[model samples]
Target: MNPLQKRCLILGASTRAAAQSALYAGYHPVCADLFADTDLCTIAERLPLQNYPDNLVEQATSISPISWMYTGALENSPEIIQAISKHHVLWGNNAEVVQAVRNPQKLYQVLKKHDLTALHLREFNHPPPANSRWMLKPKRSAGGREVTVWNREAESYYAESHNKDKLSTDYYFQQRAEGKNYSALYLASATQTVLIGLSAQLVGCHWLNADNFTWCGNVAPVLFSHQPEKHQKLAIQAEKAGNVIAKEFGLRGLFGIDFILETPFLPSSFPQLFPLEVNPRYVASVELFERAFDVSLLKWHIAACESFEQSQQEEFVTTENYSANFSAKAIQGKAILYANCTFTFPLTIERMPNCADIPSYGRLIQKNEPICTVFATGKTIESCQKDLQERSDEIYDALKIKE
Candidate 1:
């Protein structure tokens, strides 16, 4: 079979990055996503998801006979996965695995029973203590949408202010854990799981108009050469917890573990790390891995899925093997610039490297909508962050959106 004829269908909220990676891996990508932006259209034939989960299979069939992979929001609905798997080769985690990890209550119970690092979580049936700081998280949501503080001042008015029945099972509360945010990315086969890379997740950058927990981007190699031993220990702990979760849930292909180190960078006392949630799909950080190691992550992801099915791990390269090839060439980061107010794209769009999810010209962008994605790569984290800020400024300035 000709490799170019191996059509890979990609679906997600926005599949530009994955589509790009698929092209790099020598596959003909047929994409169905929310934003068929200019960049994505340049790479693959666009298929419209006319009715979403219901139309997913039909839309895919409309394109060609091909294997499919999904991104962010699709994992929340396992029924959709099952439905799609009936017709197409699904290249990621299946319905059963998604069910195990997507349920917050079940995941919390597993973490507590296994003696893994975890935060204090409570059911929404009862109100949290009036004095304690708590966060209300949707049972099934992503990219930090709708995550907010459970304000004590509004405690008494909870029942009167909202629907009680919907609150019980739709959401839960957790005592806010203070710490430095990080994510551990890994690959899993049926027999074993491999830790791939660690990254510092960028959340709530004010410049991007993102909320406190809204995911912005990531910087790979969380622990640089000069970091202390304690930081390295944290990374190891993350891997240990990741391995446990992958085995527990039978997670296959690409997965990420969100974590928090309970203290600042240095001068810490009694630092504890807590594992947050298990993201059982390809995350934003995969791009960072591809940039740092000069390898196609999407190809590895597809390969991992195939390898897991055969129960053979020999075909896959270990994370350590990839790490050995890593050099201190440059640090890379990607930031999503969100709109603070309504605006329209300028007449002339400036071309930028790694920029994606671009809004079309003359289109009205709403408040809080993502304007576009910008990227930066440098010899140091500081330099990379600086570059991101400058590029973001340029984007906002061109669109006439203010802070």
Candidate 2:
């Protein structure tokens, strides 16, 4: 280890992306994650946990004192986050903030109070109209896990399975908003927030063997292609929502908003943006932004957090900086390839270009488990997606053969 290099710890289900960002920001990242993929191990020190999330704090305590941050799913565990923060400098939202931000009821109230368009939360006991659509989502969730479409039959089955008349407080029903899914990345200081990047989200992509709201990947700089006007409108709406959420929650550092952009039936009518959830940490989609804009998002996240703690009011990074670097037509994307059946990884796949989170040779990957992440870039979104599909297909073919 270089004695002079700053050391930071990154914790999450998969920390490869955040670890890579930390490296770009000139820090030596010590990572504790579920996979500890071959590519991540080559770049950073890996702390193995006997049990995920549950053993995170124990594993973290063994490391030398340093500033640390979490990636995904960890944000859903405020108690664990609180425990870990006791021993290390927390550079992201605290437990209280996590609890408040992750609460659907609180988020709905805040958005309504600010006069911003908010997603309607349906009471678990009160069924929606027969024609309406709703989604049942876990209060503590990540990567769209445990999310399902709400229906009368499904609701009844859930009640019977839990042996209760009502759904557990751990889950809630949200009115389903129809549209294309998108995510906006924001950098916030104590006093202000700025939109850094917006990308089209790929949910349950069959090409990657992902299904039922599982987050597969993202394509950045949503080029509405010929619909430039719609693109501009969505950007404005996203920035406004980011600013509102940051102020309401006192959010600092990096956060992401997953939203739906509803293009109305009439062409002349403007599209409406419906926010799905707020991920108040370094999100998975930011990596696509980094590749697309050539900016170190983790560097900005660190600066924002430090500035907030020091009572600095100046903006950490402006929206202009991100926009200036973005090309109108160029797009970058990443897809998480999930295994369709149980198989052993046949090769040392870390040697492959444009692949991250590579599993070790001969590791058993179960059905629906992620195999690796594949990346691609092109002049248009379709071309980029096509390249990603081709890469995913090649990997699937490899998984079919035994070593």
Give one digit per residue, the lDDT tens place, for model 2 in 18-90.
9889988899999999997888999999998788989999999998889999999998889999999999999
Minimum summed lDDT over a 10-residue window in model 2 is located at 309-318
Question: Per-residue CA lDDT of candidate 1, range 1-403, in tens?
Answer: 2454678888878888887777777888888877667778877888876776677767866654568888888887788778777778888999898989988778888888788877788888876876647888887878888777787654654666565555767788877887777888887766667777788878888988998889888877665567567766776687788778888888888889888878755775557778778889888788778778777777777777874444345556544335445663468888988889887776555465557777666778788877788888877777888899898888777667766
Model 2 residue 393 CA deviation (Å) reads: 0.5
Which stretches in model 1 have alpha-carbon errors above 4 Å? 1-5, 51-54, 153-157, 161-166, 264-270, 307-312, 315-325, 350-354
> How close is every model to the real structure, measured as TM-score?
0.92, 0.93
Residue 387, candidate 1: alpha-carbon lDDT: 90
RMSD of 1: 2.6
